[model samples]
Each structure stands twice: as C-alpha cells, then as structure tokens.
Target: MKGNPSLAVFGDWDADGIISSSVIINAQRHGMIYPIRGQAIIEYEPAEPVYLSIRLDEIGCFDAIAILDVPVIDRLLESMRSYRARCPSSRIIYIDHHISTHEKIEDLYGVVEEPLVGYVPTSRIAFDRVVSLGYRPGDRLKLFVDAVDLMDRGAMVPENMKGLLKIVSSISKALSYKRDPALWRSAVDWISSPVPLSSPIAGASMEEIARLAAESEKRIRDEANILAISAQKLGVFRYIDARRRWMDRGASALASMLYRKLRAPVILCVASRDRRHVLMIIKYPGKAYRVVKMLMETGIAVSIGGHSSLGIARIPVERIYDALEMLRSSAIY
Candidate 1:
C-alpha cells in the first residue's frame, strides 16, 4: 500500500463484513501499536459520509481509503477514477468478496477480493478472506466470529456440543441437535448471542453487543427467509428482502427458520437487492427450483437467467404481489 488511509474501514453488516471492519477498527480503538502509524488527524468514519466529511474536513485531507467486506459501486468507482485523475497523491485499498466480476477489478491502487462462491450461495471463501486481512485477531473478534457462524453457518451442532460448559459453542450444539435435541438450549444461546455488528472500540460496547445480537436474531427468526452473516460493517451493504423472508445465507436459513417455526413452503435466494427492482434467484433443493423456471417461461417481461437451481433477473416490487399470486397457484408456494 502506498500509504494507509488516514483511517477508515467499510464492509457489509454481515459477520464477515462486521468482523473484518472491527478487526481493523479495534486495532485503533484498543490502542494496538501498529507498525503502520496513522496520522493523528486521521479520523474514523461510520455509516454516513455527510458527518464523516465533517471530520475529514477538519483533518484536511485523507492519506488513504480502505475498503472492506462490502464492494465499490460501479458509479462510485467511476467517480473515484475521475477524482484520482485530478489528485495524483491519493491512493485506495479495496478488500472485498462481493462485486461479481470474472477478472479482478483493476485500477484501484491496492485490491484484495475474497471469492463470492459461484457454486454456493454463501460467501464462505470471502469470509475467510476478510479475517486474513487483520494484522492480528483479538479474542473479542474471535467470539464475534463464532456468534455469526453459529447463526449463519454453524447451524449444525456436533455430539460434543451438548454440554454448555463453554460460552462460544453454538456450532457444536447446532450440529449435535441437527435432527433432534436434548440440548437445544446451547444452540438457542448461540443463535441468541450478540453477533457484534460493530466493535466496542468503535462505540458498540460489549454491553450493547448482546442486545443488538438478540434484536438481529429475533428479526431473522420472525421475518427473513435467508440470513447472511458477516463481521464487518459497510455503507450500502445490500441484502435481498424481496418477501422479507430471505435472510442472508441463501435457502438454508430460510428453510431452517420456516420449518423450525412452521415448515412453511416457499424458500429461495436472490442475486441482488436494491438493484433496479430486478432479481437473480436461486431456489434450492426440491421442486421449488422448478417453479422459478416456470415463472420465467410465463413470458414475464424481465431478464431471468440461471439454472433450475440458480438464475438471475430483475423484477419490480409493483409486480411483487402478482408474482406471489402466481407462485401461490403453482405447487411451490
């Protein structure tokens, strides 16, 4: 890196994203003696650019800009390219797993991307990539990672997870009770554990952490069909909430939440959210996938492409009700 950003980290709200952002932010928060010395004027930003600029202006000029778990929007990338053309001294570091591109996105001074699986719905590869960027992982970050994995990926508990002797043991519990459970409490605790959305150093303290995690869990359980997790935080981190059922991890969280609650039928995943009202979808497992293909065959005026299992297209919310009605008549809904 030519020079580290005065200081900033950006990622999605998922476990991978949140943790990734926190790992770096905490480095500053808890007072890590980073060999990479940042200018005291370098301020950290969260959520909004409007307020962030207030501080950035006070600092005068940012040395570098670091991007994490999330992605750089195409237009913003264009803007950066244009701005950089004017200011030759500025540099940027982008570490991300999103941004659907076959070749690595070029032009940025430094770029690192974790693979957003072409075959699997979850960005498992990307999550690991996020963790690798940290200069060193903290215990708090580790616990936060377990919390997200428990809710997002560690849905399966092993035989050893039955005893709630340890605090961070949800995956073990979930796996232990994948089918039936003598100790579902541990699994529930894991799901209920506060997956840190932001680090205590960044102002999301441990006390607040539990509450946020509980809120997120309740939201996912009650509403979303798919649930994605990340340890980073970013601007404009997108999650597809077409039916408000799809949570984050594609069809798995959807199916589990549905059946765990009432075995409700319709469960699927989409490629994009907040993207021009169109969607790319992946309906997993059973014949539900076939229903997706059937929808495209109806000659709906939209771009729909993917396998019977996975496809991409876009649809407006204005047509959402009509689409649902169509699915209702079909056997999938």
Candidate 2:
C-alpha cells in the first residue's frame, strides 16, 4: 500500500474548512484524482485532542490523509508517528497555515495555503484552491462561491440578485436543510438585482447595501441585541467601508482578543455586515474564546457576550438555534 494511493482529507471546521474540503473533493470529482475518500472534522481551534481521537482511529488503513485549516498543535505531530506505527501505509499531507514546533513528526507532505482575508475561513480558501487546482467553475458558480465567501468573511457582495439568492439559499440550506456543497446550485437562476446599500439586504453596491445593512442592523439590535450592545457600548467595533473587504474577520478578531483577555462572556460584541462600523457591549460571562472557533466552523460570525456563550453566531438571523445546536453538539464549546 506504500506505493499505491488511497487518499483522504481532514480540515478545521469553519467556512474555510467546508470550502477547503470541497476544493479537494471537487478537484477529485473533476479529475484531479488525488483524494479518493475523506472526512472533515470541524471544530473551534481544531480541538487537536478530539480530532486525534476520532480521525486517528478512522484512518487505520488509509494510504494518505490531507490535513487542512487545522492546527496540529505542539507534539501532536509526534503522535502521528504513533498512528503510522499501526497503519504504516499512511502518509500525512498538510495544507494549512497554523502549525508550530516541528519536533517529533517525521516525513510528511506540507502545503501552506493563504486566506483571501487575514486567515479567512476554510471554505473561502477551498474555493480559490480548487480553481488553482485547475477546475474553473462556470461564472455563476464562481459568483455564488464568492458571494458566500464575502458574506462569511464580512466583505462586500457584487450587486447581483442571482448570486445573492444562490448564496442565501446555499447557506440557508446548509443551516436549515443540511444541504452539502449546494448540489442544487445549478438549478438556481443567476439574475442581476438592483439593491440599495442602505436596504436590509444590500450586496455589492453601497446604496442598496446600506439599506440592507440598516435593516440587518435593526434586526440584530432587536433580536440579537445583547451581542450588538457589546460593540456599541465598548466602541471596539471596527467597520470597513470598502466592499469585498474583510468585515467578518474584524468581528472574529475582536472576539479572539476579548476572549484571550477576559476569558469570560461579559462582553457582548456585535459583528455586523461591513460598509459601516458598530460599537457596543452586552453580557457574556463564560469561556468567551470558544465562540469564534465554533462559529467559524458553521461559516458564520459570532456576536460577543451571551451569543457566543449560547453558541449562536450572527448570520441569517433566522437560525439562532442552529448555531446554538452546533456549539452544544461539540464538547468544547
């Protein structure tokens, strides 16, 4: 089995995680033929211990496993050797940007991939990586992926109705119906819609986008208000006026900082759509750091305060339970 190839992929769960896995799988599906089988373990911070327990046992006889968007953490690479002892046929290939300390792990494949945004989620990375792998999707498909990536990354969307709907449907399906990779994307029509920036659902343009954002802001304040108040009150929220810019990332970055410093949920931070800045504080009080990881896996941004502790991320607004359920399902969050 050493010379023969049977490949698999594993990644950290985040928008990037989903997209990255999709890239590898899409590449294989489209004739890249590198990976024949795989499973992605989504988690906040890649929860090295949990991934090791589950994926280690699962890879008993595979020839290769591709690790993406996940952190191997200190000394975990040494343990890979332990796994290889039993399944000596296996080789590990890493395509990630978050590794430290190379001690203890012997001979493996490594490919560091960058995020469109500062450490963009895995899905966005996956979309571009798939293209780099030589599988150019149709314009519509590309637009759809781009739109979702933008939303997840808190960047701007192109003012195209078709792309917007495709993204909304795809994400909604993922959250509501468990649709994987939007197998039904082709059936959706891509049409251009004129949206004002100030509307509740603006995309690429500032006029309609502002309108959309205004509405979204109101909705969030009304429903997910507790989290929004954190940014509003503390005045720590950074808003990017540039379209396709990384607004969601700003929110995640804020969450990480608060978590590392406070280690509790007393800070209710509001991470809203880009095009404007928001600032506040509400009431989060538990392990605050875990929220970003959990939210990223689902391809959503986390609101500070109880929203993070509740395991709810800020996206779609209709699926608060979905995010909560995701966190509850995980042992760490």
Candidate 3:
C-alpha cells in the first residue's frame, strides 16, 4: 500500500514464462498494476531441482514478488519460506499451469499470498488476473498472450504457416534450442515494448531465430532418428535409452516427433550433465500425469513436473531399470 512499491518478478526460462512475466511488467509500467518504484526481473529454469541462479539473500527485501510460469517444487517451497521469513510483510504472487503444481496447490497457499495455479497457459492467466484488477491490455499485448497460449498448449501448426503463428513457433523453437537468461530477458523486454509484434525476440533477430529454429529442427530429427532405431516396446509405451546422448535441450520436440512416428506413448531417458540423475521425458497421448504419479508413488522419481500429455521426471541414474520395469508392469494404457 506504499506510494511506489518495489516489486520482484521471477519467470521460468521459456517463451510462455517470459511472455507471462512481460504481461505483468507491462501492466505495472502502464500504471495498470501497482506503480512500482523499483523492480527486479529474473528468469529461472523450472526443470532444475534447485534454483541456484536466484539468490534470495542478495535481493534484500521487496514490496511484492511475482513468480510466473514456475512449478511448485520442494526447493522452491524452501526458498519461498526463507523469503517469507525474511520479509514477512512482502506480498508474493505465484502463478503457473503445470499439472504437477496444480496437484500441490494447498502447499502453495502456505508460502505465497496468491497462488493462481490453473489448467491454462500462465500467460493467459497472468493477463486475466491483471485485467481483473480493472486494467485493459492493448491489442498487441493481447495478441502476444494468445500466441503464447497456443504454443504452451501444444497446438499443432503447419510448417508452412505464415504470419504471427509461424513467427511465434520459430521463437519458441529457438528458445528451446538454448537456455540463455540474457536472451530470455531480452524477450521479456521486447514483449513489454510498444511494437512487440514488429520486433524480434530481443537478443536474437528474426533471421537469427529462423537459423536457430532450423538447426533445432534438424537436431531433433537426427536424435529422433537414432532413438527410433533403439526404441524398446515396453507394454503400451515405447522407451528409448538416451543415456549415451546429450539431449538436455530439445527433449520435448524430440519426444513429440517420436510419439507421432511410433503412434504410441514415448519415454526418453537421458542422463544429466553431471551423470548423477536420469531425466525422463514422457510424451503420453493422455496419461502423462498418471505415469508421473506412478513413478512418484513407487519412490523412483525424485522430482516430477509438466502438463497433461507431457511429463518430465528426475530419478537417480541407478534406478532407470526399476522405473522401466514399473512402467512395464503398470499397464498404463
């Protein structure tokens, strides 16, 4: 309730998350949200177990904090508690749409002032929440949110499609190819600008995004081609062991392609960079949550998160065989 409050904005390191953070920031800049005197914009990788990039102690204190498109994980819960204890009066607003977070909504309420977790894209949810505060967004911002909604929802667009849809897809693919915090921040700045539709995703120009998208598509195709040959049919799912391959990036795209090619659910397992954990990317037709729940219940997955038809799990590298056997016996068709 201060005259000019300081705010901190944290978003996941993805197109949807970046755009969602932009929606709130743009609202504040236009006097739609509170008139903030100062702010911090930080992007984080939600898939990681720990958010080492964010230093709560260094941030000092804030009037409010808005977390966008980030899942509710154990480490995040601990961090939020620490921040809450440090600044008891600070308002915290957490918003996300991942199924994993939705299942733990009760826990979220204990840490943040407002937890806007739902089934739609976080960009749309953020836009709607801002609108509910009696501020109308511009046509460009609305269009930008719609584009992110499509991308986050896994809407299929034709490869030759032209115009905004194609441009949005290219930007999403480019973001998926690499994890660049600077690039993500640039995207947020671009989205918050006046002529967002006219501008590229900040650090990367349109031509550069196109080049990255092309390269990403090729790498996905190459990885899928190799994995397809070694894919194992386990019960109703097609499992691929990707331990020998480096696929920290573009795992989602690779899984989607394999899903379409195999005409069945696809599970790709890749070892972490440190080789301490196994990352399982599951592209199930409609039972991704069930699969993830099973893994968690069986005590095989250390962390699990994602959407309805897509899920990601982290397990110890040694438990890979146990996870596969559990899935094989569950008959999760």
Candidate 4:
C-alpha cells in the first residue's frame, strides 16, 4: 500500500449504506486500513448505466475504492470492470450482505469479501472487517452501527437505545423520501463525526428529517390503506400492484408497513420511474429468497436480489401478471 493513498467510497443510499461508508471513512481518518491523505470522494447510489460511467469518469482514479452495502448487479459489475481496466492498480473492496451478492460470490471473489449470510447488515460487516484490521470504533460509532444493523434487519431496538433508534429511523425515512445525495453525504459525515448518535445532527437536521418522515408517513398511510383493501390473496402470499401509487419514494417503508398490517407475507409490484421494469418487493417471514428463486426459475424475473426475509426482483412489465400467477401457484412459499 502507498503512503497517503487517495480513496473513493461508494455506498447504497439507505441508512445501512450511509453508516457503513462512515465506518470506512472513520477507519481511514484513523489511518487504519490505509493512510488516507486527503478527503475521500464519497458517493451514494450512483445511477446505473448513464450516471455510473459519468461518475466514474469524474472520480478519475484512486488508490483504493471501497464499496459498501451496494448489490452486485450485472450493470454495476460491468462498470466496475471498466473502471478496473482503466485503473488496474486501484484496489477495490466491496462489502455487502445481500443474498444476491452471496449467490454471485464466486464471480466477485477477489473484489468482494465473503458476505455474512442472512440478515446481518453491511454496516456490521464493514465495522467488523475494519476491527479485524485493527481499527477500533468509538462508543458513539459502535452504538450507531448497532442501531443501523437492528433497524436494517427490521428488529426492535432495546428500550435503552430507543431514542437513538428513533433518530436513526428518522434520518433513514428522510433520506428515502428526499432521495438527496447531499443529504446522504451529510449523513455519512454526521455518523463519522464525534457527535453522539442521540444528538440531533446538523445539515441533515432532526427538524428536516422529522418533517420528511411526517409527510412521507401521511402519504404512505394512505397508500397502505389502499394496498390493504386491494391486496390479492395468492395462496399464502398477498400481492398488490403499487404501480400507480406515489410509492417509488417510500417503497421500503410502505412494504414494511403493509407487511405489519397484513400480518402475512406481502409482495408489492412497483413500477420503475422510467417504466423500464417492475420491481417486486417481497416481504416474507423467512423465505423471501425462495420467492426470488421461483421468479428466476419461472423466467418471470430478469434480476433477483435482497435478503432472506425481504427480496427485490425486476421483471418486464408485460410479465407482471405471469409473475403473479406463478407465485400464486408455487408451493415454495
């Protein structure tokens, strides 16, 4: 490793991604994995195909690139290969716990660390990795990482940490609704700073997050009611077409809300903004990947990803009905 190496950090747009990126940044600041000389070029959720290439070009080259919590999709793999060809010496480390990444681990062997199987969040993975490499996080970052991990897994926070969890959830909801890269970056910086996770961080302030969460909750509550009323029962699975709703912004939250309301497995079919494809967000107790596999095997899904209890699949809009039928008939669930 070179002394004072330049670095590039990329993370998914969610709270897990933001907090995981912060772990890496904190490690670099402490001169742990690599002695980072300058501020790393941090980016969140680089847009696919178009923006990815443009962003890579803008980043030029770095001595190392750290990718956290981002799924290893085909398009992203292609872009990473192109970047590698252009900068052969730039070491790239991808850390993710998505079942999609786990399925493709062989192809991504050298670049990706062995993903922790099941519900572990990428922030926990990143923190553990840095710790194994001799980087110890402070009390605040550790608590924040715990909050992110529990929240990502849809688990309840301890009563003592409920306040911290609320702050984290508020920020996550704000980011989901706002979809602002600057806010994401601000969140990473906030988590990396010495400010306690319980304290209201500036830039991505508590007031702003609260306002966004409130607005998002209002719309999501209305949409949830609609989904509850119209959700189709397919065997043991409940399916709802969320294409016409304003759900692209809060799809995750909406799915979670519906899951709780239905008290059974729910699948949401949300259309992409560009209408390029439909996203199937599956919320199941423990077999979400089974649903994704069935979709892939039936050729209903073009791409499949996500966790054991929550899965995401992309399929052609024309085959949405076919997918519903297959899930309706499948015995896997």
Q: Which candidate is the best by TM-score?
A: 3
* Predicted structure 2: lDDT: 0.40
Reference-based lDDT, residue 175, model 1:
27
Ranking by TM-score: 3, 4, 1, 2
In order, the Cα lDDT scores of the candidates are: 0.39, 0.40, 0.77, 0.75
**In candidate 1, where is summed lDDT lowest over 10 consecutive residues?**
230-239
Which candidate number would show the highest lDDT if scored against the true structure? 3
**After superposing candidate 2, which stretches have Cα over 4 Å from the reference?**
1-5, 36-49, 75-79, 97-121, 124-133, 137-141, 161-333
For candidate 2, the TM-score is 0.43
The full ranking of all candidates by lDDT, starting with the best, is 3, 4, 2, 1
* TM-score for each candidate, following the candidate numbering: 0.47, 0.43, 0.90, 0.89
Question: Model 4 over residues 12-69: C-alpha lDDT tens digits?
Answer: 7777888888888888775455324454544344232334545665667777777777
In candidate 4, stretches whose alpha carbon ends up further than 4 angstroms from where it belongs are: 1-4, 35-54, 110-119, 153-156, 196-200
lDDT tens digits, residues 122-174, model 2? 44555566666556644544554565567554555556655454445333323
Model 1, CA-based lDDT? 0.39
Candidate 3 weakest ten by summed lDDT: 40-49
Off by over 4 Å in 3: 1-4, 32-49, 52-54, 152-162, 200-202
What is the Å distance of residue 135 in model 2 from its true position? 4.0
